[model samples]
Target: MIGTLRTVVLDAPDIKSLAAFYADVAGLDEHYADDEWITLNAADGTRLGFQRAPDHVPPRWPDPAFPQQLHLDLRVPDMAAAVEHAVKLGATRLPGGGETFTVLADPAGHPFCLCQSDGDSTTIADVAIDCASAGPLARFYSELLGLPVTWEGEGGAMISTEGRLPVIFQEIADHRAPRWPDPAHPQQLHLDVEVADVDAAEAAVLALGGVRLSGGGDNWRVYADPVGHPFCLVW
Candidate 1:
C-alpha cells in the first residue's frame, strides 16, 4: 500500500530566492542550498525542495487560457493575520470572497489557500506529489514555498513545515510536462507558497530556479518550475 505524503517539489528559474521566501514565510529552517537547488526542514522531518529551470513561466489563475489543474490549501490560526503575513512575505491576494478559507500565492505564482485546522502534528496529513526525480522537484518546491525537504528516497521525497502540513513528491519514470491553454494538455498539478513581500518573493523565486509566467504588476503572479509545473504567489 502507498504510504503517507512526503515532499512537495516545485520547478523554477531560481532556487535560492524561492527557498528563502518559503523559509521566511513558513517559519522553517533552511537545510541545504546550492546553485541549482535548496532544501528546507519541517518540524516533523518532512522536506521541501526547489530546483532550477531557465524557461519557467507561471500560470494565470481563474483564466481559462491557463487554468489551474491542481493547487494547495493551507491551514492557519487566523486567516486575516495569515494573509497579512503572507502579503508581507511577497504573496498576493486573489479577487474572491473570504469565507472558510483565504487564497494566496507563492513567489512562483502557484495558488494555495489558508484555513484553520486542529490535528496532531506528527500524523501525515494533506497533499502530496509524486514525481520522477525527487531531487530536482523537491529542491524547486522547497525554495518556492519555504517548506523543508525532510526525506529522500529512491521512489520519492517529502516536504513539510512546523510538523503540521506536508506535501509529498514521488518519482515517476516518464514525467510529462503540462501544456497550458489546452484542455487536453492542461497542467496536471500546482502549488502555493506563502511569503512576506510579494515583490521580494518574486525576485527571490527568479533568483533561485523559477520564471515568472504572468501577473507581475498585479497582486498575483504566475510562475513555472524548470519542468513546467504552474504555481503562483499572491499578496
Candidate 2:
C-alpha cells in the first residue's frame, strides 16, 4: 500500500455552512476550523474536511457536462426522519434512488445518497466516486490504500477500508474528469492520503498508473489517480 487514507476533503464556496450541514445531518463534530479549511470527525472516526473554494462550481448530477465527480453515502436508521432532517437543513431532493437509498444535494450542490441503515445512528458509509470505468479506479485505490476490493459488479465496485466507511466507484459513461484549479471543470472533492515517505510513495504511485499534479508543499504532494481524480500524499 502506498499510504493510508487520511481525510476526504470537499471543495465548498462556503466552508462554514457546508461543514455545519454535515455536522447536523450526519452527527459529525467539528474537530478544527478556520477561514480556508474545516475538519469534522465522524462518529465512526472518519475525518471529513471542507476546503474553501471561493468560486466553486457545484456539480449538476446526472448531467455529463457538470458531472458529479464524487459523493458521500450516508446511512441512517430512520430513512424518513433522515430525509426530513436533510431537506430542512437546506438539502434539496434530487432525482434517482430506490427502496434502500435516496439522492439529495447539499447546500454546496454536491449529490449524496441517504441510505437506509440497520444501525441506530447516522454515519457516512462510503465515499462514492464517479469514473468512466469503475474497475480501473477501484483497482487503483485498492492498491494505493491497501484496501481490498470487497465487491465488484457491472457498473460499480467497492473497496473496504479499515473504518466502517469504504470508498465506492460507479461507472459514468460520460464522466467528465476534472481539471484541477479550473473552476469550470472543478474537482468537487479529493482524498488526503497519509504516507511515511513522500518520495518512496511518489515512486510507487507513479509506477501504479498515478500522475504527479502541479501544486504541493513539504508535508504534502498532489497526484492524480489513473482516472484523473486528485489526491494528496501527506506525511
Candidate 3:
C-alpha cells in the first residue's frame, strides 16, 4: 500500500455536536475543530473525523432499504452503564433483539454499538462495513490500507495490523451502496488515507480495483473501492 489509513470519517448534519458526542463517549481529546470538520484523537491510538453534510440522510438500522453503510463498534467495561451514559450524552437506544451488544443512534442518526469488554474504559474495537460479501471487500481494503487479513470466515473477515484499529467486513444478505451527496442515500461513513503523492496513489488505487470519483486538485482525491465504499487519499 502506498498510503497509511489515517481516519474513519462520519457524515453529520452538525459537525460540532457529533464530534463532541464521540469524543465524550470514547474519552478522546479534541485534536482539531472547525465549522466544516472536527477531529478527535483517541488515547487507544485511533482517530475519528466528522464532516458537515447539510443534506445528510440518517440510516435506518435493521432496514436494508436505508442501510448503514458503515458502523462503529466500541468495547466498554459495562454494556448497560455505557448505554446509559451514551443516552445521557444524546444517544438514543435502539432495539437490539437480545444481542449481547447494545445498539444506539448518535445525534446525527448513525447507529453504533457498545460491546462488553473486560476493560475499565471504552475503546474503539472496529470500523465495520455492511457488504454483500466479506472476502473481496476485505481484501480490497486490506491491500489499500496495508493491513493484513487477520481473520476470515463465511460470514465475515477482519483486517488488522498490530497497534492499529481493525477494519471489519460483515456479510449482510441485503446490502446497498450509498448514493452519496444525495439525501435519498447518504454516505454514512468513509475512510481517509495519507499518501506521499496524489498522482502515484491514484494510480496505485486504480490498479488495485479502485475507481476515482472526485478530486480536490493536488492535495487529495476520492475513490470508491470494489464494494462501492468511498474513501479518500490525502497527502
Clash count of each predicted structure: 81, 0, 0
lDDT of 3 by residue, 57-159 (tens): 8887888888889999999998888889999999998877245698999999899999988889889999999899999888888888889999999899999
lDDT of 2 by residue, 1-235 (tens): 8898889999998999999999999999999999999999986689999999999989988788998898999899999899998999999999999999999999999999999999989988889889989988899999999999999999999999565468999998978898987899888999999999999999999999999999998799889888888999999
Q: In model 1, how large is the Cα lDDT of residue 202? A: 74
- Most accurate candidate by TM-score: 2
Q: For model 1, how does the per-residue alpha-carbon lDDT over 44-150 read when each residue is reduced to its tens digit?
A: 66566676755666545555444443455555656677678888878888765467677676777666666654642222234545445777787777766656788
The alpha-carbon lDDT assigned to residue 175 of candidate 3 equals: 85
Instruction: For model 1, give the 10-residue run with minimal summed lDDT.
Output: 1-10
> How much lDDT does each candidate structure score?
0.62, 0.91, 0.87
**Candidate 3, after superposition: displacement of residue 199 in Å?**
1.6
**Best-to-worst ranking by lDDT:** 2, 3, 1
Top candidate on lDDT is 2
The TM-score-based order of candidates, best leading, equals: 2, 3, 1
Off by over 4 Å in 2: 161-164
